[model samples]
Target: MALPSFFVTAGRRWLKLALALGGAAIAQTIPAHAAQPAAPATIRLDYLHTGNATVEQYAVERVVIEPLPWPGNMARTVDDTDRGVNLVEVVDKASGKLLYSRGFSTVFNEWRTTPEAEKTNRGFEESVRFPKPEHAVTVRILKRDENNAFTLAWSTELDPDAPDVLRKQEPSALRPIPIRVSGPSPDKVDLLILGDGYTAGEMKKFEATARRMADQLFAVSPFRERAKDFNVWALAAPTPASGVSRPSTGVHHASRLGTRYDIFGSERYVLATDNRALRELAQNAPYEFIEILVNNDTYGGGGIFGQFSTAAANSDWAKYLFIHEFGHHFAGLADEYYTSPAVYQPSGTRIEPWEPNATALRDPANLKWKKFVAPGTALPTAWPKAEFEAYSRDIQQQRVALRKQQRPESEMSALFKRELAHEEELFSRAPERRTVGAFEGANYEAKGYYRPQMQCLMFDRSEQFCTVCQDAISTIIDLYSRPAQR
Candidate 1:
């Protein structure tokens, strides 16, 4: 995650400019709008030293910039090619001249807007290192159009020598600690989970939910038996209110359910949503193996490996979303169906997947889980197709009825809650709680889209991942243990 050497040189030039500008005039010219009372922008900078130096003593050698959500209600679209024009400039606090200037583009994937989507949504982080005496730095951003006309969007100052205020303020109970075990330290895999909304108090309420989700994740294949090898850091912070929801006409149409919307665009972040921002955050947590966003609601979540994973914060089914998505985030598991938003364009006609479970062909020779297939077992397990269809229809009808209710105390809540509770109780009675089966209601398809278990936490509102998922989680932990000594 180190910034390239060329970027370090650019930062130096920006600093030189800032030194030449001097501080007095620039300080006085603070925008009148900025002077007026408004919500104080909460900008946090965490300097991480990939080498032996401590973050405080570490001299920033380069600055990687990540822009954050803008402050307004506006529909703006920047393609990856068009985004490269945005520039970040670092200035010497005393001089106001630029110390470094670098340009980066927005993400290539198009993100549609909904009125409920977070407004002025920009999320990026920057890493800059300084030699000589570490000094205070002011960071400014200039976003330009095709004509090169620039508009100032953000400015902030930080002392590289100082410790991170937020880290220190984090409650000890909420901080991540190494998971200990007998023998050598299990390969450590850190999960740094970001938050959208869910204020500190709300986070506390949802902490148990988060921990339970993590526990369920580790309980699945790959992870369950190796619980001591991982660390989880929940970076819970409230997002701007404007970021809660937006109008959308695309895949985000799922947001209409209120139970499926993620105001912060969690999936976008994982898919290298914005290179500049992702790089910055990665630099901050260079050792992180996965980054999940815990949004504050009963909404659905998404995941992608080497990218990001997300889940609802306080939903009754939060545990299910967390571990199910982790299957995608950690093991590169594919959606067991052909539906949902076409976020990933299928290329070529190949069917076998690198994932451990999903398969496109009935032929054992082509499936990834051939080793696990039983002898003489049918290609597709016999399932109660008709019964499942009837059950699904019933559930949908109940969901529609519940959605129409206006109050939390409505009869609809009682009915939905009762059915959900009954399902949970039934799932709990299984002898091999971790075993996988043909679980209904998963991915986006109702037919071939089956999960590994008849009633796993991944496929329903249960509380534990199936054995296969546990194995996958464990495998990921093992993969991260050994260093690639290339």
Candidate 2:
């Protein structure tokens, strides 16, 4: 059977680069013996699949890279400039033939560079797709830099005759268990919200916040125009009771926390929750997207294609968080700013990003969005620092006021139950409303980053969706629902 075209191109490139490098080294090291025949390099490949099909799909979506450490002291230090490994081939372990290969730059600690500092080890990670059952695989790495003449990094072998694991991991095939919210299958989009840190008694509080978020989502594009076409599954898993006794107050001190709370920070937590939620949504309703409702007010959220989740730090800003995060989930929109810490390193100066929207296109002729941009829209939208500073101060004051006002517990419960119309009204009339120019506090940088609209729900504490955001949401919905053209 023929391998994929990408794999073929990658393999050829790897072979060419390896041969050239090896030839150069041999000519220098043993000039007299260079004419003698050299042995062909031996390569091996392997595949390691976690026993869950959903997890396998999630892994591919997240771009998990499994590292293959070089054996022996090939170089003086792991970070040596001249030291590197080239991925030669990805092959089926059951058969010795190559399935895929690529000639790509291998950085020592690429993951820790910028965006990835907080997430992974500062080491090499190659981008490889997750394989299905009977597809046992191995990747071949050639260490050909000045330090190492030749070495095989790692490989895997699998028993193809064994029973398949995918069948058992499929959620629909598993026995059904009772879960929240079942019914008449409206054409409604299913929104899944994962809980972060709400205590046992706080379930209602979280639920109300989630409902408000759902309302905000519907009020915006895609969901807004199609309000009745949606249902929300708010998963309020109580934080384990006996984990570690810490302060009951909302303020969390890092010192006294234990394993349960600590696990929330793990990548595993994010992946597992996402997989389960997506599976359930897929099995149930039309399953539009998944949203995670975070409990803390620290202000962080993430989204991916076919998935949208958000957290409500405080009841007041629930609308803003919901809409802003949906931008990422709905649109493959790149974060406009580069300041905040991220999970993946900014792929350094060499290769351009594959995201449709953002790019460091220094050349105006090659800009990806040049066609859509108005002829006069500046390449870098300039923001006056003085204006931004004033805006920041006003936003800070509003945040302070929102945090200080401790609504009665009953009111808080009502807020969670979606019974409080006053709170929604308050959000609509927020003082941060500005009809013109760029408003700060979006994407990342409070200054350089400006959202496309003036007072969008993504940019401000409002329930209104800006025209640009609305269009984006609509496009995503169409993409998800549209059938492939012949």
Candidate 3:
């Protein structure tokens, strides 16, 4: 074994030859990220958005440099698809030039519509993230005025290199599992499917559900067609139990993300109010969008535009909730259903809604989706509203009673199946079922507001999005799937 001097010399000569080649062979010595230019660090401005129905205010909490680089598409720095109630603009402090802007609705905005906000003062911790600039920058948050114009709500200046900015953080042992990776984080839509109530023993079940839901998401049109434009990742921090809190039925468990059912006294509403806890865990993954997976079979989910969405991963209609709630979070689309009870009290005035799918129809001739209208189609489209409302109203009554009685989840699922079957049968016979005409009743209103179609996933448990909703979602898709402009 000690007499192999000739062979050792031959191996050294071969390595020298590879090094002299001066191409991929030489580049192999360096890491891939090192070979490419480093991405800008992700900067998050955490703040308190607090106040009531008549007044609102914002104050800074702290700024943090997230662990991962910005997962957003750098080629398209500006968001052109205007949506949401608020807009965030980042400008160069000294030059006063706009650097980045995005439209997003906060959880506080939704909460403000509820009666609770009218009676009490509450604060919500919200965050706006942007690519870290080299120097100081001004962050401005704008809210819509009564005239529907975006006016400055709050402004603050901060330096990325400031001493107070949090740079170092506790290392996360959590790692993301790739469900479907089409390309690099910046080039594709990076969606993080986070689990909130999975125990260490159920990690594998969480993973399987995540993958299954992700696949079903792609099975829908648009997403199915544009499947290659996305990268899906799943990550879950172990919890002490397997299901999230459901206070209505006296079922409670300690959850890592603070996600729970019965949000705002609505038994079927699920939400996580703790933004910091959610962000801390999500920061470990390269995600531009997050869909929290709650380990429960309850018929509940909630979505806030630009904020994260939650769905009961174990529900019988899990796929429906997964796609529908994501539609709200990803595209800022509003609910098109109205027969169901909502926690939010309606504002006295019926101003035009900002959502792309729903409209006030103040000027029907100039409808937002007028282009899709057939030549002879009515502006205020007529449908079997009376009969449909009669059926839906009865279903709503049954729904409330079932929850009041603390009925089994299987009964709820069966009721949903019946409701869907009735809706399908009812709509299938209508002439304007799939038409692009405006249908009265949407945005939690039986009057004034109108949706683009008679039935859509946004409106009901239908399988497809309405034409207008499809276009609206596609616009957002293009925003994320920015063409290589750089």
The better-scoring model by TM-score among 2 and 3 is: 3
- Screening candidate 3 with a backbone cut-off below 3 angstroms (N, C-alpha, C), the clashing residue pairs are none
| Per-residue lDDT of model 2, residues 142-214, tens digit only | 5443333545644444332344322222333322111222221111234556555566787777667766666
Highest TM-score among the candidates is held by which one? 3
Rank order (by TM-score, best first): 3, 1, 2
Candidate 3 lDDT, 1-486, residue by residue in tens? 121121111112212222332234334543455322235668999999989977899999999998766776666667887798999999888888777899999888888889888899899999999888877899999989887789999999989889999999998788777777665555678899999999999999999999999999999877888887887888999999889998877888998889999898888889987899999989877787899999999889999888889999989999999999999999999999999989899878889989999998999889998989989898888899998999998898888888889889899899989999999999889988878988999999999899999999999998998889888888887888745421
lDDT of 1 by residue, 1-486 (tens): 233221222222322221223233323423334321111111234332122111112222333222221111011111111112245566778866454443332221123122222233322323322221135777655555334455664555666445542212212232322222111111245565554434545555445555566666666555655555554544443333312332221323211112224233432122223333443333232123444444444345666543466665555555666776766666555455322233433333443333444444435443444455455544445444455455556765665554445324245435656666755655466443333344333444454434555554445545555555556555555454423211
What shift in Å separates residue 298 of candidate 2 from its native position after superposition? Answer: 5.2
Task: Report clashes for each candidate as comma-separated counts.
Answer: 67, 27, 0
Tell me the alpha-carbon RMSD of every candidate.
16.6, 18.0, 9.0
Evaluated with lDDT, which candidate comes out highest?
3
Give the Cα error of residue 305 in candidate 3, in Å: 0.6
What's the lDDT for residue 166 in model 2?
A: 26
1 or 3: which has the higher lDDT?
3
Cα displacement (Å) at residue 474, model 3? 0.9
Q: Each model's TM-score?
A: 0.50, 0.46, 0.92
